[model samples]
Target chain A: MSAPAQELPRPGGFPEIKYKRNIPKVGPSGLTLLVGITALCTFGLYRTGQGNLERRELEREKVWARIHLVPMLQAEADRDTYRREVADKAREAEIMKDVKGWKVGESVYNSDRYQPKTYAVVP
Target chain B: MSTYREPTLPTGKFVDPTPAPAESAHPEVGATSAPLKSAAYFIGAHCKEYNEDFMLCKNENADPAHCLKEGRKVTRCAMDLITKLRENCEKEWVAHYQCLEKNNQEYYACRKPERTLNECVFSKIKLEKVIPGASGTPIHLRTDSIYS
Candidate 1:
């Protein structure tokens, strides 16, 4: 009756309809991300293994060297001493030859190559 | 406590103008050469036993003349090795031989550039400084002298 009652749209007219489209069903790139992470972990693991192998080889070589060092050093020392003694002997022999006026390699003192000259003692 | 002062008054023929030569000045006493014993020991491959025997003879007061056999044995052994060394190290041998034959000098000249002959001999021979009392020691002496 109030001016044909301007039909005041019912307060909740359109049945409260709301539109939604399955949220586009978005999922992370799970397979690609998983592969990338797995590859990175594997590379890191391989590098660590390689370093360990090299370290072990070096350790083995050092141990072997330590084991044989003493004998090698001793042999070198003996050879050096022998060489020195022989050189000294050669020098002494040369001096003896000079004093006696004997030919080189002559063994007059202990051999029959020559004899010492003797003179009468003066009283 | 007082410094002592000695009296000096005698001045009658204190010094001899013509001093007599000391016996040690004789050439034989002063004769120097590469010691025969060491030469025999080092140059030879296996003459330690012979060297020991020679030393024993000397220690017993045997005349040096009596030791000639052992001495010759040692030299012969060394000479044998030296000959082999010449064959083994021909290059070094030529240099050493030329020095001795032409220059009339010892083989030591070859050692100036490098110890070629020495290196060869040492490789082929065993050098022992002392004769061990223990038996069963190896002896590598050859019987005949190459030079002779």
Candidate 2:
């Protein structure tokens, strides 16, 4: 029997397929920069939230002032006028305490106490 | 293998990206360094109740004249308390007024029931009545002997 013919090798062979692994790398400085950025962003968000809260609170206060404080101030003015009136009446009473015999038109008018305080308004 | 590249900031382009602190954070700015203690604080705290009354009146669409009566009572009562506070807590009141003159924000910020003002007033000013509920009827319609 003739010797088996040797298997012939292919002429132009295809390049062998090769797989390469690539690992991601981050340095110490890169990690520090990332942490800093995240912290700063978090702080910024917190401050913005705080500012918004305060602004809303301030607006509420302004509205309360407009609705309540203004009218209350006016009422306070009226109360002040009443207080002055009461003071004047008290002063008049204290001044006339020593007077004994007094007539409504004659003797009452003659006394210095009945002459009215210099600052008092004449009706 | 690739070598790590350092990030470079351009000259004259490096800027601070942080926000400034709030005014409340800096107490040393002005008169804000000191706490407030004033007559208005005590009375204002009490006025909250009266304000609720006023709001209720408004909600009911009550007459302005009637609503004003309630407001008048609150104002009068507050003024009376203020007089007492001035006489009793003179030192605190004076300090607070000075703070107000120096800085309005500090003054306004101090107007709280929990502030030193309330402490001063509550300890010093003695009062028979706290909140005068409501002033009923108009001034002209009152047939009280005191009016006559």
Candidate 3:
């Protein structure tokens, strides 16, 4: 009882009390990260769209080219056929030269019994 | 050993090839797929009349002998167009076709080089690449295409 015991002040404030404010829940670093992710996703979507458009254009071109190619290809095939026929006629003439009364390209049977058919003779 | 003889071969009937028609004597166009694709539209535009005539001849008769003259004309016209392109737009032509060769001969993938070649051909050769049946503005001329 030495002069009523002096009251000791608490060593610190109540342990449950917080000194700093958490007003803005997200920090500047977190906001930056969110923005970066959004931009990257948008860019990826744009690239995908661009790739699709290019693929469609390629398909269109292929179709157009194929349509236009028919006539040219037909003409090429015709030229080959004409050349082959000419060669065949020449070969037939050479082969039948010595045979008596053998017409190279005429029908072989009397009274149109057998019409002339062009056979694909191998050389 | 069994005497399994192959049939006796026929003799004295050799294939004596004759010259092709004079009109069809020109050498074939030597360009392969990529280069030909690069110049396809231009060739179409340039050879329209000859191509149409050849087709008409083919329609008249299925016999190829009937269309030999028209076919030769078509071949000549295509060769002429290729020659003109080579003479006038060599650099641009090479660049565009090389791009096409790299990108599977797809026209859309080589628009930049194609544009250069188109401009050159139009200026020097006075020939334009016209798609035959495109309804509206051709896709090639569109500047705002996202893929381009």
| Top-DockQ candidate index | 3
Q: In model 3, where do residues sit more than 4 Å from their true spots?
A: A1-57, A66-73, A96-120, B1-23, B135-137, B143-148
Task: For residues A42-77, write the lDDT of model 2, one tens digit per residue.
Answer: 999987786565455444443433444443454443
Tens digits of per-residue lDDT for model 1, A63-118: 33232222222223333333333344464565565465545434437765433224
Ranking by lDDT: 3, 2, 1
Candidate 1 reaches a DockQ of: 0.02
TM-score per prediction, in order, is: 0.27, 0.39, 0.63
Fnat for model 2? 0.12
Please rank every candidate by TM-score, starting with the best: 3, 2, 1
lDDT of 3 by residue, A6-99 (tens): 7876788546768788787655688798999999999999988876765566567667666545456667767666676667767778877777
For model 1 the local lDDT of residue B1 reads 12
lDDT head-to-head 1 vs 3, winner: 3
Residue-by-residue lDDT tens digits, candidate 1, B1-148: 1134465555653332232223111111111122221122244235445545655654554333344445445444545544554466556545544544443333222233124544654665543322223223211221221211
Q: Least lDDT summed over 10 consecutive residues: which range in candidate 2 chain A?
A: A114-123
Which has the greatest TM-score? 3
Judging by TM-score, tell me the better candidate of 2 and 3. 3
lDDT of 2 at A51: 58
